[model samples]
Target: MKVKHITIIGLGLIGGSLGLALKKQCGEALKVTGVDHDQETLELAVQRGAVDYSTNDWKRGVEQADIIFLCTPVLQIIPIVEQILPYVKVGGILTDVGSTKGFLAEKLLYMMPSGVHYVSGHPMTGIERSGIMAADRGLFKDKWYILIPEASTSPEAVEIISQTLTWTGARITTMDLYDHDQCAAIISHIPHVVAAALVNLLGKYPALEESFKLVGGGFRDTTRIASSNADMWADICLTNSQPITQSLLQLKELLDEMIQAVEKADRPAIHHFFKRAKVRRDILIEETDSHVV
Candidate 1:
């Protein structure tokens, strides 16, 4: 089914980018409406051509939408979903760009009214900078977009949602909700936590603070995402606490092994650990390179 209009809530980086990408691909065929509490963001989205319509009133934005992308924070996504359930058109599709999927699936499965379809999605793409000003039309290009649909979800709903995402140049991958959260925990959530932890470690030692001034590319690159919005990260960490904690514990176990090996002067074990990591890193680089073209 053709999507005539899409209403994007939040009007932040993800929401604004979706609107821009849709307008670029569908041209006049699709109408994009941007909804946000911030009047400045709504106006910026319109001025930047990311959206055709801007409104602080979500009811007006979503009333006629064929699809609604609830691009709010993870904690806010559920509440917004509840609020908009009554307003969504019958047969209309609703999706999200949240990082965590398990919480959403659990909360929305029974709350979703009949006639409206819900498909949880996470676009594996973003930058440290956020908000409408940082929105980029190419944000999702060639990036992975994971969709988690329940067993009750209609095939037609998944197809329509998949078709809509294709317009943004994303590579769509559908997976079970639990598996999605586990993978995200390892690849995204734990990494952010580690980044922040690394930064915090520096704060703990004021004696080395002066020496830290000489930190180079490695330090900057590793902690680049540590500067992300605190509120957003806090909500994500809370929502996906279980998986994130598991991943962190696994990391701790590995670190303990490495520390013991180094303390024992076990050259062979240290070499083997480094070799294993190098092999995996090389394979990852090779795989990423193969996908570039």
Candidate 2:
């Protein structure tokens, strides 16, 4: 089962880059079409050779494609899914590149038209920037793509989609949607809140902000993705607010305990906490570096 007619909705950074990747991988076997809300971006995608055809109309393009990729923002995904559900071709493979998954995917499932095969996916890679010009063809290469396919999804559909992703140089992994969302709360969403807080801290103290001039690679790296689309990030936090709040509280508790330990001159308590954390952090860094290399 080869994918021929493909329509990618949203010609933003991810969508445009995906169109190019699919063309490079599938060659003539795949015919890529892109639908974008912005006419300028849609035309840019076509000019860049990312898509064979581009349009702003969802009804005309989405309904007939054999494979459709939803690359829009997280919050708008559900409504967009519902609006285009009727147009999705029978047996069409549906997928999305969204950060938060569980709640959104489930909503789409109940609302999606019958006979359409949908598999949820998130490529755990991207920079702080976005838009058509910021598109990178190798963005997903050597990165992890978490695919959450529902029980109703066919094994054949999963296989074909997995193969397509492998062509983009991404490693495929599967997880339950709930677990994925919870995991993202700690690793993804919590960090954005922290960075946004850190930047706000710098903003509050302009005089002391000269200290930012002394900031090194670690600070820059830590806050790099903090510069992403604010509206999109707001949606991510709001969509998974409960888990993010829980993580934030847990972090607050840890810091409070550390402060108490420092006030009491509890050196051993501080040492124990830092030691455990460093060990785990090192393991994660090593694992990520190993995979990337």
Candidate 3:
């Protein structure tokens, strides 16, 4: 079925971008409604042409929506789902742009009404920034938008979500909920923690603060993600604690091995470590280039 009315909650970067993308792709065929608790954000989203209509009243925004996109923080998605479940139309599909999906998939599948559907999703795109002003119509273009559907998720819901997101030029990936979380913990969640920890390490050396001014592109590039929304990351880390923690433990083991190699002046072992990492990194670059072509 064609989606006519789409309600997007949270009106932040992802939500606003989805609004702009829908407008750009579907034009007058689809009506985009944006809901946010912040009035300034609603105004900014309207000014950016990212939304056709703006509302603070979520119930009103979702009442007649054919599809609902919860673009809130990882933890907020399910709560919003619960709040809108009563107003969501029968057979309507509800999805999220949350980073972690295992718990969300479980809870949403249980809470979704008999006729309604919920599919947990995560878009592997964004900047080191936030807010409506940072919204980009092309943010999701050529990016991976993952859909983690539980056993209860309907095929119709998956198709609807895939079709809607396809307009944004995203390459859709379908995976089971558990596998999705495990992958995210390694590639996304743990990287954020590593970035933050690196930046925080600088805080411990007040005497070397002056030396930091000399740090250039490498430091900035490595820590760019550390500037992302803290509260949002906090929620993701907590919700997906199990996998993130496991990944960190594995990372710590690697770091310990590197430290031992350095202390023992094991040049051969250190060289092998760096060489192995470089080989893996080059392989990733080659694979990415192949995919782009």
- lDDT agreement of model 3 with the native: 0.89
Q: Where does candidate 3 clash, by residue pair?
A: none
What shift in Å separates residue 182 of candidate 3 from its native position after superposition?
0.9
C-alpha lDDT (0 to 100) for residue 74 of candidate 2: 88
Q: 1 or 2, which is superior by TM-score?
A: 1
Higher-TM-score candidate of 1 and 3: 3
Error of 2 at 224 (Å): 1.0
lDDT of 2 at 231: 83
Instruction: Put down candidate 2 lDDT per residue, 1-293, tens digits, no spaces.
Output: 66778899988888888888888888888888999889899889988878999888878878779888889988878778777888788889888898998767777777666688778888888778988888878887888999998777678878888988887888899988889999999988888888888777788888886678998898888888789889879888888888899999998999898999999999999998899999999999998888874
Model 1 off-target regions past 4 Å? Answer: none
Tens digits of per-residue lDDT for model 3 on 139-218?
98988899887777898889899999999989898988888899999989999999999999999999999999998999
Candidates' RMSD to native: 1.2, 1.7, 1.0
lDDT for 234 in candidate 1 is 94
Error of 3 at 47 (Å): 1.2
For all predicted structures, in order, the TM-scores are: 0.97, 0.94, 0.98
lDDT values for all models = 0.89, 0.85, 0.89
